[model samples]
Target: MGFDPSRPDIHLGHVVGLRKLRQLQDLGHQLILIVGDWTAQIGDPSGRSATRPMLTHEEVMENAQSYLRQFFKVVDRDRAQVVYQSEWFGKFSLADVIGLTGRFTVAQFLERDDFAKRFAEHRPIAITELLYPLLQAYDSVAIQSDVEFGGTDQMFNLLVGRELQEMMGQRAQQCFLMPILVGTDGVQKMSKSLDNYVGVEEAPDDMFGKIMSLPDEFIVSYFEYLTDAPVEGQTVNPMDLKKRLAEEITEVFHDQQAAAAARDRFERVVQQRSLPDDMPVVSLSTVSGPRWSNALVSAGLVSSVSDGKRMINQGAVELFPPSGQSLKITEDGRFEAPEPGTAVKVGRRRFASFQE
Candidate 1:
């Protein structure tokens, strides 16, 4: 259970592997969660088209602390032994590094898909990147782990660990690969970099909405990976299935009451086209003659004016006038002062009222 602290948050994609770790823990196996503090500086080259920026020691430690907090959300902390890879790597000397690197060859490193593609394309593969898998392999040997779990993309690295363990006269460890959870886009793997991830630490309403926004086709896989719910030999409407999936996942990170309240808020505010009772009211300095995109930014509904413009272009922004009929902001256009009690709806879950 080696997890790279490349980011500060753990998303549903990471949960797929954590769930397997939990299953192993339940079976009375000792779970070692290795925080890749040493490897984070080199970065894991798996599934990357470009060189990943290295993190500072401070950044890596900060991210590791955040990761541990979120990781325990699904895993039992008492049964899991968390360690930093620096425990061993920091003790390595120049001679030790030379000996470790000598065990593997350039040909062996290039055999990985990421490395092979870079080599064939004549891309600059950093020497540090080549050492990533080797260092990760040494982790397994140092811990003397019996089994390693990771996503399918990590198969190469996990296999390297098994080989290194056997090379050290220890039994080869078993590698268990989990299917990558698709993002909300239903295309790329769920990742925070792509902004398509549903973080375990997200607000209850936000988590619920992100799950609900997932494509209907993903309901089955979401059920199989993220929740304890049964998916086999069951037939249900895709919408109904998606709702159940959302509720089930929401309950895992949050309690059942919070999940129910979030579902109710989503139905009342989104599916039923009614405003939330506690929707935050944002006051604008000048409510009149403001660009819809700017208003959305001012109200904290969207991250930026460009994001607000994109949402408007996608017909996801609407203006609900207190007196006149509600209107969708179809174009990136400005509006005259909205009615005194007007409210703006952005996407499926966010709402803000405009006031002077």
Candidate 2:
């Protein structure tokens, strides 16, 4: 299996394949994990509207370093042989790269959905993107893989690997394509860049809350792909099923005790419309100014300053000042940081108790 370091974390979307790989390992298959350190710079063009930004080798390696612990949650670390592309690709000369590119034509790459559409609309397609599938294909050749695992979106790349392997006189590997998990938005596939992903390494309460916020329709699929527990039937309320889904999936990444606590925390803050007993605390110790945006980011309430503004403007945020009047963000109005002991509510799930 090949995973690039384009992102830092392996999310629940990836768990589907990782789980299957574990089953294979139990059947005594040697799992070779290929970390695409070199390919991350070129960026995978799958499901993209335009060319993706390249990453520095340093940045790619840093993200790759963080992948193992989350990866080991499903696949055994000791049972797997982890390899980086730099080990092989670093030794390639200009002549070698030219040779590798010669094996495929531009027409072959344009057959991909993203590439085809971009070409029809006269959008820019980078030469590096055309090389992405081939580099990924070479990984299979280098590792001599017998079976490859990837998401359905990667069908084109996986097929290229099989073809590349056969051209090198090796047996063509079987491609195992898994379903792509939909994001919490319910419209798009789960991706880290979209901010709709429920990261496996997120806090129990946070993970539980994101799952709860999913559309009712996604409840059943989440159960089928993410957890072993079975959902009862359509007779049950969808909201209730979503909660059960949240608890079951949460229990896999965390203990039942933590999952239960998170469920209770969700109910208290969202259903009951009250502050969580253990609401996260935002320390005012190092804050440079009385910027509300700074507080939101520091407490992990919002992702960034722009996100904080969006939530506030959407009326999803409220500040319960010590004076008992709720303060709201207003254009051309004072939106200073809350006083110490202020309680901030961002949407229904996130709460921050600002403290000096």
Candidate 3:
């Protein structure tokens, strides 16, 4: 399979292809991985709305190294052969590139969905971007691959590989395409750039919560793509199914114990309206200027002061004073500490306690 490490990590979307490759590997097929160190500079245009920003050689290499480590989490390392585009492409002359480009036509390239849309919208399609698929097609030739695995969005690039191999007098490779997994947003495909992705390397608690946060309609799809769990034809409630889906997926990447702990934490903190047992203890003075947003930031509940402020305005922040009447952090700009024993809850999962 030809892989361009456009991003550093493997999101669940990329796992679809990796899982298939592992299945094939288990069936005694030899795996040849072609890393797109050179082609990444051009950037693959598949499923892109606008042109992708080109990567420097240094950035591409760093991403490629990170990709192989994550790639092995699903695929076996001992059975795979790794080749880089720089191996042959570096040796190719301008005449060779011109000859390679000669075999394909502009009209043929325009047939791709992303290119067609860009053309219709009169978008600026970079000339280097046009070279992406052709470069990828040449990877199949370099490796002389028997089968190439990719997402359904990569149909055009994979087909180009088959044709390019035939033109080069090599056997055409089989193109195996898998369904793309949707992100937590339940709209776009899972992508690290989109920030809706649940990464394979995420902490168990974070991964579980991210999965649970998805729209209920996406539960079955997550189960289908990320786990071997059977959910089809089951009439379970969507909420229960969602938790099952989250736990199943969380267990695959983490241990069953970790998954269970994450589920329990979610139940206690989110569903039961109870503070977490492990909630951090901080001084009331940690708020410095008594800034509620800064307090959340210091507690590591939110990414930034602005996000903390937004959470407060959205009524996601509350202080449980000793009087048992919870006071909501309605004012984002400032906050007043009620009592020494007051407990702070931010959003649905994060909690902290104020000490004297």
Ranking by lDDT: 1, 2, 3
lDDT of 2 by residue, 286-352 (tens): 5443566655777788888788777877878777777788876543233455689888898877788
lDDT of 3 by residue, 30-93 (tens): 9988899998888888888788788899999999999999888888999999999999999999
TM-score of 1: 0.95
Poorly placed runs, candidate 1 (over 4 Å): 232-234, 286-290
Candidate 1: residue pairs that collide:
none
TM-score of each: 0.95, 0.91, 0.92
| Span of ten consecutive residues with least summed lDDT in model 3 | 283-292
List the global CA lDDT of all models.
0.89, 0.87, 0.86
Q: How accurate is candidate 3 locally (lDDT)?
A: 0.86
TM-score of 2: 0.91
Evaluate candidate 3 by giving its C-alpha RMSD to the native, one decimal: 2.0
Model 2 residue 5 lDDT score: 78
Candidate 2: list runs displaced more than 4 Å: 280-300, 303-305, 320-332, 335-342, 354-356
Please provide, for model 1 over 1-356, each residue's C-alpha lDDT reduced to its tens digit, 9 standing for 90 to 100. Answer: 88889888999999999998898899998999999999998899998877889899889899999999999999999999999999999999999999989988899889899889989999888988988999999999999988888899999999999988988899999999999999999999999889899999999999999999999888888998988888755566787778778889899999999999998998888789998888788776644236878878878899888998999999999888888889989987665667767888998888888876
